[model samples]
Target: MAQQVQSAIPARSGGNHPKGLPYLFLTEMWERFGYYLMLGIFVLYMKETQGEGGMGFPAVTAYDIFGTFIAFTYLTPFLGGFLADRKLGYINSVYLGGALMGLGYMGLALPGLGFFYASIALIIIGNGFFKPSISTLLGNLYSEEQYKDKKDAGYNIFYMGINIGAFVCNIIGAFMRNKFDWSAAFLSAGVGMFLGLIVFTIGLKHYRHANVLKPAVAGDTGIGQVLSLVFLPAIIAGVLGWMIPGDILGSDSTDAFIAATIPVIIFFVSLYYRANKDDKRPIAALLAIFAVSVMFWAVFKQNGTVLTDWAQNYTDRQVSESMEQAAGKLYLAEEVSSKESMVTQYDNQFRTLKDDNGKEVKAMGRSVYFRNIDPARIPADGKPVYLVNTELFQSVNPGWVVMLTPLVVAFFAFLRRKKKEPSTPAKIAWGMLISALSTLVMVAAVYAGHNGEFKVSALWLVGCYGVITIGELFLSPMGLSLVSKLSPPRLTALMMGGFFLSTSIGNKLSGILAKTWYNYEDKSHFFLVNCGLLLVSAAIGFVMLKWLNKIMQEKGVK
Candidate 1:
């Protein structure tokens, strides 16, 4: 298989060009389309009732499931990268992973609960292979001299393509869900993934050269050894944790998950110790950055969790008849009749209840807003207000991603010309600090709303996303650039896995925070906690900056 892959490799063109790039880009874009499409509806699907063809889970449960799924998806890149580097070769793994993920997406559209969970498991494992492999391929392409200077720009462009898919998929999800059923929306994700597979196949001639299998390094364990040590122990530990624990992770599933990850995490840490002296420092830096960046992910990923709830129920979504007609025509606004709107404030005035079955619940009323608002603020007509869909708020980050990428690139370019640009680490610190400020915007919005007395304007939501997007522009891309710049050549994919692991942990934290939404009486404190977390993370990054910069310079990265 390795020989066949090697023989099929396109000859490298002169001047640092690898035979891949375009194929990888399109494959990534379509892969992101499927992933983001599923994400766009995941929360909504969870919150939906069984009568509506959903699992009918509570919001907290849904958040946990959502977080766990994304967490594991990022967590798997370690295995994927290893397999690509040692045994399977990049192309075969990509094909295998993409096929699994596409089928998983299709399976999700099937009608059984067992199928749903199984499909999610498949997708999660599949992503581990597909995600890091493509990224490593890009790095390998740039290893040639002609492309080395352009690697950062290439990654930025690739990142933009990712956001482009992310930006568009929500719209597709919205239309599909509104026009048909949730199943249709999920099915669309599968179709989009398959399309990505087809695009990758078409572009194979371009990237086949980059798919050459790398020889294993000295002292590298065999694939059998790795699987025995990592996968087998992980499975055993996970089963034991799930079976013997009483809420070790607050739930059996969570316990199993945390246990399942221990082996993988330990393996990566061991790599640092096992690396040759020349490789250790860079790996150490990568690990440090990974640790600090988890906090950013924890805070940033709230767009689909706590923040989604805020947009759904707290933001002022009311649109006038004329404006509604126009917005609806543009597919930007969703119209709900008075009876259908879920906008509600769970204030002291609202009496909680349960039937004999112990299913604690609240009474259905016009808008939940009436429960918390002063009498004067309640609408006299009792008519339901037309509001924008909560999912649209998910677009804000990507929207900012698209709008600000060029501007950010230009800003860095300007600084580059002067040689005054912040190091990538510095930019990430700045991103953390600026992101903290964005949370304060929400703090102000909460105060302005008088502690849930009235809903705030959607403009507030826009302002927050806009501010955070700037921080994201600084941090997210820079993180990727840092990984590309600092990782040892042999361990690039594993380090990329490290980067995603940070994201995975943060995503889980985001869910954990969102799970506490029901416990907070003063909502401003919730956002303030997020602000404090980011601020502390930023501080830590800043304190480490000089040392980190010294390493980057020693390593000869800009």
Candidate 2:
């Protein structure tokens, strides 16, 4: 990979992007389509009753599994990047990874707990091999002089491709699952991955030249060294954590993740101490940023669980019969009627609809909104209504991303033009602070809805996502750029891996917080915890700003 970075690589003759861009774009679009599709429905599947064809795991169990899956998914990219750098070329790694993910998605559609667990493992391993290689291959494209100046712009376009896929996948999921069954929804994800593989193969002629495997080089940490120093100790620690009697930190999985991180953290710190004199300050600065960034990621990643809970159970989702009829014609919404069997068995919420004569009747489903609707707002009894699909809420964040990206870019450009833009570190600090503010939006919703005994408006969730989207634009993209700018030349990939490690930890912590949903008596307290974490992170960033800025200036990068 380093050789590919420094070698004289060929470039497209014209000013246009290489022929690979469109192929990679479409390929990644489809890949994300598959990923987010399963993710959109995953928890819903886990928590559903067996009669509904779901796994029916307990809420905390489901959330813990979700967090572990998400954490391990991020964790493997380092290994994937390592394998690509050493042995498997980019093209082959992508092929292997895509194939595994496709199979995993298919496996998820099948019955049996064993298949489900094994499938999750396959997808996690596949993502490790697939994710970093493609990104690295894409980065190699801009290494050519022709594309150098437009590197950022190229990535912006690529980033939009990801959001486009993410935003659309949930609608696809809602339609497939609501119309047919869980099997159909999972199968759709598999098909999307397969389509991505096909597109990648079609574009092989363009990027194939850039996919060469890099041989072992001086000062590189060998696989044996990594195992002995990091992997071995981590595995032992994790086993110990899992084996300990009783729950040490909420759950066994959480305990294992925290324990496993100990050795990994030590390894990262050792990198700082072992760095050459000139590299130490930059490494320290990036490490500081990584530490602060964890809180942001932990809170931000709850979109799939905590936020999904709100969308599924706490918001007004019922639609007019006319609209429902129209949407149902296209299989676009979940259909719930006033039928007696539609109510979740043995758990009918206390509620009654009133007629013109003032007699009481029932119109209800498993949707929490209906379970707790104010009687005054209930339509005349025995009316059928359709609820907006729960999976559609998954699209909200990515939808915001699509809408907000250009605005954020223009805002920052405007600042840069006036020489008033915040430095990268400052932007991240403010991003955390802004994220804290977004939690207050949910707090307001909780109060407005009277602790969820009343169905709140969907606008509150949308509003929270809008604010967080701005913060995401500030922090996420900049964190990637920061890693590229500050890392020591030989250690660049390692630093990138380090950045992802922080994200993996944050992702797990999100799950830990989410698992506490049942523990909180008032739903408002759930969101408040998210607020507090972000506030603490922002405070840390503010305190470190002066020293971090000095390091950035010395390192001569933003």
Candidate 3:
């Protein structure tokens, strides 16, 4: 492979930034639009009865699948980044990955179990190729003399675009599903991905300079060697775990995933051992961050599962006429306007109704929140009311992210001016602590709700998201920037993949933790688990702060 596929980026005097930012920004926006749109409704779709064109899986089964799917989606980035660095140039990889993802989303519109599974596989594989490479390429733009100082800001802006896509997609997802069907909602996701591809292609020339492919050096491990050591062993381990008679972990799939991951973990450890003296400390620092971050992601990533459940059944969603009217304009309202009180049936929701002979019928109601509404606030027998769509709750974090990105960027900039800006390590430590604090808000909400006997105000969720968003602002962009600033040029994309790997682990754990929501009689305990996770992570982060910062300084990375 050539060392660098450098294109002459168009020069703009005093601009000091690449023209490609807008293109990348918009491309990522649409990509996230598709991804988040699909994710926002994924669990809901899984829970629907088979007669309703869903899997009709049990809650445990659904979460297990969810965990596996998300885990595999991120796992491929390591391999994808490796290939992009060694063989396929970044541009080719991006196009191929985007097309695969688009096709995967569209495939969901088709019927049958095979197609569904195949579509998911396509998406997971495609994401591996798409995610890390693009971020690595974006970081490449900052390698320019004039743009280096602006890298963090650029990443923050890029992150904001991601949230913009996430925020808007839930609106679209909620409207599309409510207006049409699951097929229509999924088709919309496919269309969004294709649009992202078009945007990426349109800006090909601008990103071309950043598509450098690094060739293997004399001492580097070859693809064949890596496959033999990592993939081969992992596959055998997973199969053995799956075939085992009893549960070694939660389930067969979880057992297999855990087994499969062991070799990969070993591979990372080996990387540290093999890395030269110059690269070892930085790699070690990143690995530490990666490990601690698993806790944060485990808690933060529950938005789709546990948090969705809270919004759907526990929270007060009833909105006033004016609020409903405005939200409807944004495609954010669910029509709970029917006056009839005939109860419906669904899994994971509850209502007590009388059967013909005075026997209790454990029915599921349309507005299950009705069960938790204050007796006085409950609509008289058949009165109509409005509620925001449950999926709209998924947008709260991303919305907060978009709103606060600028302020966060400016805050760090302010600190920089005063020569008091916290180092990246310090920022990450604080991020974890703040993340721990966010869970307390949910604990308060649980108490206020009387353990789902009454509805808690939406403000609790908003507040939690606000606090977590601050944590996200501190750690996420900084983590991305740190990888770029410190990684060996040849291994930059690989390290980016590493960060995603950590997040992947956390995401899977999030699913696992969410799986236990049904088991928690005291809802506050659920939030407490999340709080404890972040607290432990924060403690570890604080303990290593001095060491991590020293490494950054030694490596000449801020």
When summed lDDT is taken over every stretch of 10 residues in candidate 2, the lowest stretch is 5-14
Q: What C-alpha lDDT, on a 0 to 100 scale, does residue 526 get in candidate 1? A: 91
**Tens-digit lDDT track of model 2 for 1-558:** 212212211221113555566677677878888999999899889977676799866666888988888888877766676667677777888899999999999999999999999999999889878876776666666657677544443444455556778899989898889889999999999999999999888879888887766665555577777779787898899999999988899889888988988988898888788777888899999999999999988988888888888887788887665687788787777765543333443222212233576333333444334567665545557455677888898898889877776566657656766878677788889989999999999999999988877888899999999999888877876776666567775454556677777888899988998888777768788889889989999999999999988887897654
lDDT of 3 by residue, 312-388 (tens): 78888888767866766666676663444444443334422335873334343445556667766656665667688
Number of the predicted model whose lDDT against the real structure is largest:
3
Better of 1 and 3 by lDDT: 3
CA lDDT of each prediction against the hidden true structure: 0.77, 0.78, 0.82
Ranking by TM-score: 3, 1, 2
- Give me the displacement of residue 172 in model 1, in angstroms: 0.9
Q: Which RMSD values do the candidates have, in order? A: 5.3, 6.4, 4.8
Q: Is candidate 1 or candidate 3 better by TM-score?
A: 3
Model 1 per-residue lDDT at 556: 86
Predict model 2's lDDT versus the native. Answer: 0.78
What's the ranking of the predictions by lDDT, best on top? 3, 2, 1
